[model samples]
Target: MSGAAAAAPVRRLAVIGCGLMGGSFARALRARGLLQQAVGVARSAEARARAVALGVVDEATDDPAAAARGADVVLLAVPVAATEATLRALAPALADDALLMDVGSTKADVVAAARAALDAARLARFVPAHPIAGKEKAGVEHACAELYRGAQVIVTPLPETAADAQRRAQALWEAVGARVRTMTPQAHDAALAAVSHLPHLLAFAAVHALAQQPDGARFLELAGPGFRDFTRIAASDPDVWRDILHANAAEVRAQAAAFRAALDAFEAALAEPARLRLLIDEASRVRRAWAPAGAPPSP
Candidate 1:
C-alpha cells in the first residue's frame, strides 16, 4: 500500500455511468485541480444533462465510445454486470496510453470482464479498482466533490497489469484525497463478500421480512432509530445491488452461510441465560475494542 501526493493534471477523463461513484470521482479530481476536462456518459439523456448541469463533467454524452476517444483516463463506474460490455465498447475508442480503472464493488468479476473484453495490449493498461466509500443515497444528484476524501480505494491489479498502469491508478485516487491499497482480485472479492455483500443481504432480508407481514405497515410506523439505521442499506438501488451480488455470488453465499451459523448460535444461546450473557459480553467487548481512544468506529 502507498499514499499519493498531488501530481500532474490529467488532460481528459471520460467517466462512463456518471452516477454516484463516477460523478464523485470527476468532481473530486476537478476540485483538486488535477483534471482539465471530463466527459460523462449515462444511459439517459436526462442523466447526461444533469451531470453537466451539476458540473460533474465538462461535457456529457449517451455514447460511451465517443466519450472514451482521446481520453487520458477512462473510468467505468457502471453496474458490475455491465462492465464487460462497457469495456468492449470502449476498446476501439481507447487511447493507446489511456489508464483504465473501475469503481465496481466486486473486483474478481470486473477483472474477469476486462480480460474477456480487451486484447492483451489494452488489458495491460487496465487496472481494477474499488473505492470503499458510498452513502445509502443513490444517483448522480447526490454526488459531491468531498466524497473520496479520507476514503479507502482498493486497487486490484492482475498479474499482467503494467507497472505504470498500477502506479497511475494509485496516483489518481491519491490525488483525489484517497488512501490507496493493493490486493489480488481473488482476495479482494472474498474480503468484500464478508464485509460488504453479506451485510447488504442481511439488511435487505430484514426489511423484506418485515414488509411481508400482515402488520408490516404497523410495525414500520412504530419503528425507531435502531431499526432505521440497521436497515438503511436496504434502501439502496435494487438494480445496482442485484448486479453486484450476482456477479460475486459464490463468495457471497459462503459468507452468508457463515453469518447464518453465527445467528443460529445466538438464537440457541437465548435458551440459556448464562450462555446468552457470555455471547453478549464477547460481542460487546469486541465492538468496543475495535475503535482507538478518541476515535469513532470505522465504516
Candidate 2:
C-alpha cells in the first residue's frame, strides 16, 4: 500500500512455533507464490512432524535459531510469554538484512522484548504485527490459506522502527489479502484489550461459573445456540490465552472492571421492569450496529 516498490518474493520463510497462525501464514504465502521455501520450528517433535506432513513447511525443527539461519523473513508466532525467549534465541542466527515480524496479540510487551534482546541494527528490521483473524481452533491441522483473506492486520511499529521494515511488513500482509493498518503499540494493545481480550475473559468466566453449579451438566445439555455462540471462545487454547492475558494485564483489568460496572448496573435494574427492558434494548441496539460496514458473517 505504500508507494515503495515491492520487494522480491521471500526466498526462505522461517516460522517459529508453527501452530494455527504460523501454519496458516505459510500456507497463505505459498498459495500466493510469495514464498519459495518454508522452515517451521516447534517445541514438540510431533508438532514439527505434523507441520511437515501437512505441507506447511519444507522442513521442521525444534530449534528456532536453526530454522532462522538462512531465512529471508522470520515470523514469530509463539505465545506472548514465549516471544522474548524465542527472539533471544533467533537473534544470533538472524541475517543482517532479514525482515522480522510477529503475530502476537499484544504488542507493547513484544516491542519491549525486542528492545532488550536484539541489537540496535537487528531491531530495526523487526516490525510488530497482529492479524485480527483466527478461529476457536488451534493447531496446524486446522490451518487454512484463506484465514487472513479480507481480515485486518494491525502493524504497530515502534518510533525507532526502520521505515523500510515497516513498509515491507505491511506489503507482505497486503499481498496475502489482509488489509493493513498502522498504529502505536500502546494504542494497539488498549484497543485489542477492550475488543478481544475482555470478551475472551468474559467467555472463560461464564463457562467456568456455569460448570461449577450443581446442575452444571444438566444445564449444559439444555444450552441453545445463544449459549454456544457466546461461549465459543471459551474453548480456545488456555495456554495461549494465559500468556496474552498476562502480557496485557493492566489494560485487560481496566476493561474487565468497566464490564463489571455495566453488569452491576444490569443487576440493579432487575427490580425495575421498565429500566431492565431499556437496558436490554440499549445493548441489543449497540451490538446490532457494531458490525463493520459491508462485512458479512463467515459461512
Candidate 3:
C-alpha cells in the first residue's frame, strides 16, 4: 500500500497507562482531532478517575481489556517492567487489526515481551515505538499536549510488523507534531544508551554525589542556572529510569564505561595547565557552534 493508504485515520485510541507520557499522547491526539474517542487504562481506581477528570481520555477504566476493546490503536505507556503484564491483560480485548505501539525508552526487551505476550496472529500489528522527548518532571499533572512538538520519534519495526501497522504508528505520532524516524531495535537501544540513558544516569549520580557532600546544602543554595540545567533530568521518575537501565543493561554498562574513561581523561588534564586550558577552550567552542539558534533562553 502507498504510505498514505497504509495509514488510515485512527478513529479510536486506547492508552494503557495514564501517566505523563500517556496523558500527553492522549491530549495531543485530542488537540489534533486525530481520534474520535480515546480510552485510558490505569491500574488504580484513583488513576482512572484522574485520567477521566483531566479529560485525557473519553473513558477511563481500571481494566485493560475493557479499555483496549475495539480500539483502532493501542499505545502502551506503562513502565517497561510492567509492559508484558499490560500486554497480556489487553491481548484478549485488542481488535484483530488494531495497531499496537509503545513509548518505552528501551526496545529489545519490550519487543521480546510483546512477542511472547501478544497472540501470534496479531503480531504483525505491533509497531514498537519510542518518542525521544520528555521533561524530567513526570506524572499526569506535568503532562501537556504540546510536549511532543517537533520531537524525534523512533519507530522500530520487527520482522513480524506489518507495513500498514508501521505506517499507522508513524501517522499517530506525526499527528501529535512529531517527526518520525525508523531504526533497528538494536540501533535504537544503543543510540539511546549513549544520548539519553547515560545522561540521565550521570545527572542522577551528579545530584546524588553533590548531595552527599558536607556543604552540599550551601553549595546547592549557590548553584546557578548551569547546575539546574545539568541536573534537570535527574528529577525524572526513579522507578522508570531503573526499568530502562536494567532493560538495556549491556548497552548502558558499556556507555557508563565510556563515560568514566572520558571523565578520567578530563581529570588527568586538570593537572596540566596547558591541557586543561585546551580542553576547556575546545569544549566551549564546539558547544557554542552547535547550540541551536532561536532556542528558548536557558534558565
- Write the candidate numbers in order of decreasing lDDT: 2, 1, 3
- RMSD after Cα superposition, model 1: 2.3
Each model's lDDT comes to 0.88, 0.90, 0.85
Q: How many clashes in each candidate? A: 0, 0, 0
Q: What is the C-alpha RMSD of each candidate to the true structure, in Å?
A: 2.3, 1.8, 2.8
Higher-ranked by TM-score: 1 or 2 = 2
Task: State the TM-score for model 1.
Answer: 0.95
Clashes of 1: 0
Give candidate 2's root-mean-square deviation (CA, Å).
1.8
Q: Per-residue lDDT of 1-299 in model 1, one digit per residue for the tens?
A: 13334466889999999999999999888887789999999989899899999889999998889999999999999989998999999899998789999999998889989989999989999999998888888889999887887778889988889999988888888887778889988899999898889999999999999999999999899999889889989999887899989988999999999988988989999999999999899999997776432222454
On lDDT, the leading prediction is 2
Q: Which ten residues in a row have the lowest lDDT in candidate 2?
A: 1-10
Residue 26's C-alpha lDDT in candidate 2? 93
Clashing pairs in 1: none
